[model samples]
Target: MVQYNEWMKDVNDDAKLSSLSVPGTHNSAACHVALPSVQCQGASVTDQLNHGVRFLDIRCAKLFLASGDDANDLQVIHGKFPVKIPFPLKLAKVLDEVYAFLQSHGSETVIVSLKQEGQDTWDNDSDEFPKVIWENYVRPHQDQWYLGSGIPRLGDTRGKAVLFRRFGVKDEQLSQNLGIDAHWWTYNTTDDDRGEIRVQDFCELNDTNDVQKKSDYVKQLTSQAIQYNATNPADPKLFLNFCSGSNFFNPECWPEKIAQCMSDANIQDCFGKGCGIVVLDYSEKDDYKLVKELVDKNF
Candidate 1:
């Protein structure tokens, strides 16, 4: 039997990050006291990591300080709302949790997908979001991150947080070393192939009737990842299949409801195979069944 906490220890060091089946959570740190629409996860980040989830979908909103204060910070958010109610969750704190987990479990590596969420009032030239992240969050702890632009081997990333940057860069030099360039990812897409990374993030469900369509997209991407990895094991593109969606206006199509619908869609057929990163909402439901099934594929 594979242990949830240290499951990566069983995987071979030569395995590429893009080829392995990784379990991930969408809005991973949004498990606090927030509205149902904003809260996408049921378990805390620490719990997710301990339960064999190697990928984290973290959305950070840049909170600029006073006029001249250089000590700006990034707060975790979902869409335009803060994940936590009154007191917001900070990205630095989340990174600390990841680092602590890696220190204890030296064989495991966590892929953190960082996206700039919420409104952007700051000027792009004066305050570029990627540059802010690079200076404020990443530069301070550069050693703890895998900032390479290409897919990394598991051996090279052990005990490190692999950065999957989802924000754009204005400076030409900053763009060169700012992690895997998922900056050109399309929104609410069923299939957006950007060479190094492919995405299936069809997040808009017009109604409950659209759940099946969403599930179909999930399965299709899963098959693509499995087939690609099986044939070209040495070089594989990272596939991020998001099994999360909502209608926004319809309460029935909320995240939890969509998650329940997805749970019943018999999506398990996509599991126990190399399907890249399976990002889910409410991943803790059914005792982390989705995470466990995906993790088992490695062994």
Candidate 2:
């Protein structure tokens, strides 16, 4: 049996972060009570981390208030709605949780994929999004982060959080130090090869009938990652295969519904395979079978 909290301890330090199989949660911090369309995850960040989830998909929005108090603060959100109801969840709090987890589990490294979402209310042209992240969140805790542009070895990021930046930076110097450069890619794609990373983020489902297509795409990507690693052991590109989708208006095709369909799809074939970082929705279902399967691959 594998220990979820410290599974990385058994992995070789020389292994590249891109070459190993990793479990991840999509919209990771959206565990609070919210509308079905907004809430994508069930387990909290700490719970996910404790259950072998190493990658996190965090979407942040700039909260520019009328009074300008805490204007620089970033709120965790999903689409247009705040992830946590009654009280807003801040990026600072999420980082605190990650830092605490890393402090106790020194052998583990968390990959945080931060995307700037919900910019309809504010001007998107303003480069304040990346600036705020760099100045307020990252720079203050520089020592705890792996701010490199290339894929890192497991040893280099054991006790730190690796940044998978999804937003662009205006300043050239700041951009260089903003960790892995995954700023842009083809949206709603099944597969888009970008040299360093190959992504399969086909999120929008036209109807419930499209669920099977989504599942097939996920399985195909998983097999591709495994094959890529076998042939290119020396230098493997990260495969971010997302097993999540939704049909916005159709209640039958919401995130949970899609997750259930994905769960039923024979994912056992992916076990013990190099599936890169498999990002999922509602990862706590079926006693965390998905997380366990992905983590067991590393051992």
Candidate 3:
């Protein structure tokens, strides 16, 4: 059996990050969530990393512990649901695992799309909000990250996590001062601009959409993102396509089911040679074949 690891080592250092077919997981830390509707991934961060997942969609928040002793530095969450490790661990622990994995596999670079979830907000009114995050997560682990704003090559970030912030700490200057402005993007599609990395997060809101419809939607978004990267060429535009969706009203929108539908629909063939960052759900099953399918497109 082949022990697949450090696949990105095959890619040249001059190859643009935008040109790589990055396999990512949406709500990557939500595997511990008990609810079927909210859980997005079936693999732990380390497992996903071993499975050739290069991008991680991490949602975090500073929260009070269950014992009410003190707030954890950061907790990986999925909307209102709290995902925990065996006994429970902070977001920092998960990141440590990612860091260790990269350290062991020197040729692999990981993209961490870090976003704030829950009631926490990076507002100017409360300076402590962003301050706590910096002092705890960013400051302590600064050395393990690539904070550059530009799209870096694989060699530039190997054995490191490239930070893609999704929260606004303050005004333009203030956010920059807080170090939150380095390669950040608007929260949603409505606020998206063509100049920065564009994202498509289309999901079935009412579950009225059938499996075929949702599959087609994923294909359309995937194709457009690949085309965008092709035409932009020189521009460092990245297209993040979210292949995860859910509907509280219908179990059909569950992530596992959606992933199955995608696999059955043969959508992987539509990804072509450059699909940018393709984030998926339920990627742990089938030896993470879905993620491998996307990564294979880079060749």
Candidate 4:
């Protein structure tokens, strides 16, 4: 398995994350620290308690692979900070593949971006995330993988999130699906009554617009995660679970408010600085994947 280790941290609220920082690692994608922008580059990290994660400049980023399956050779691409940086061509290709694969999975996840909580120019709307989502809105649907997780951070949580936008969206149909605003990707290709269904199929099967939908799904999933903890306060019960704000997908953290209350009683990763904090139920994505499979097969 490709285990990702922390590289380094400098905790800067100003740096725009450029090339000089990463002189060694082949940069493919660089994420802006939604909270505390660190100044360190690629430093091998494993300890969960390391201040590196809390370095909070960027959420998660990785260098693209070498010239193999994923290669583009692009000069530089825009980052979450709207700053252009060098990315190995091969790495960009890998990101594109990951994006496609995620789209195909159709699972939802609410990303607590570690980037600075400020507006981004690339996004024209009121805020960066909403703006980027509005134009690139990929409305979440039933079968998509993104719908899997979405929730808000409790207590003194940090990090901001942008619901990644989707393309090839329809107006009314999408509106009905998400119970949110509807905006298509410009023009429709066909005019058949079943066009919406066909379009959905295309998006799901080809994974072309998978990133948009998956990103949206995650936003919604995380935003509403507190519901899982919706147990009666009078009869409060606590379950030994782990949470680092990412516990929205944890099984015990379902139903929103109930789960939040449950998490409040247990341990927390201390805003991700430490790791022994139990939120609701501590598990990995596979936990939900199994649940999703069971639900698909049974109910």
Off by over 4 Å in 3: 1-3, 65-69, 85-88, 120-124, 171-174, 177-193, 208-211
lDDT of 1 by residue, 1-299 (tens): 99999998888888889988999999999899998898898889999999999999999876534243332577888988889978878888999999999999999999999998787565677536777788888999899889998999999999999999887777778877778878787789999997878999999999988999999999999999999888887667899999999976899898999889889997877775678999989999999998999999888
| Whole-model lDDT, model 3 | 0.72
TM-score of each: 0.96, 0.96, 0.87, 0.23
TM-score of 3: 0.87
2 versus 3: better TM-score goes to: 2
User: Deviation in angstroms for 23 in model 2?
Assistant: 0.2
Which regions in candidate 1 have their CA more than 4 angstroms from the true location? 64-71
Judging by lDDT, tell me the better candidate of 1 and 4.
Answer: 1
lDDT by residue for model 3 (1-299), tens:
22346788888887878788888898887888466777787778898988888889888776644423246467777776666643444788888888899889988888887777776544446655456666677778787887776677777888888877766565454455342142344433322445647666666545635667766766886787688777876776676777777776688778888887778888787786677888888887688877887777777
- In the order shown, the candidates' Cα RMSDs to the true structure are 1.6, 1.5, 3.2, 19.8
Model 1: lowest-lDDT 10 consecutive positions? 63-72
Q: For residues 203-267, what per-residue lDDT tens digits would candidate 4 score against the true structure?
A: 12122233333233322322222222233222212111112221223433222222233234321
Candidate 3: the clashing residue pairs are: none
Regions more than 4 Å wrong, model 2: 64-69, 120-126
Model 1 residue 73 CA deviation in Å: 1.4
* Model 4: CA > 4 A from native: 1-85, 88-98, 103-129, 137-230, 233-299
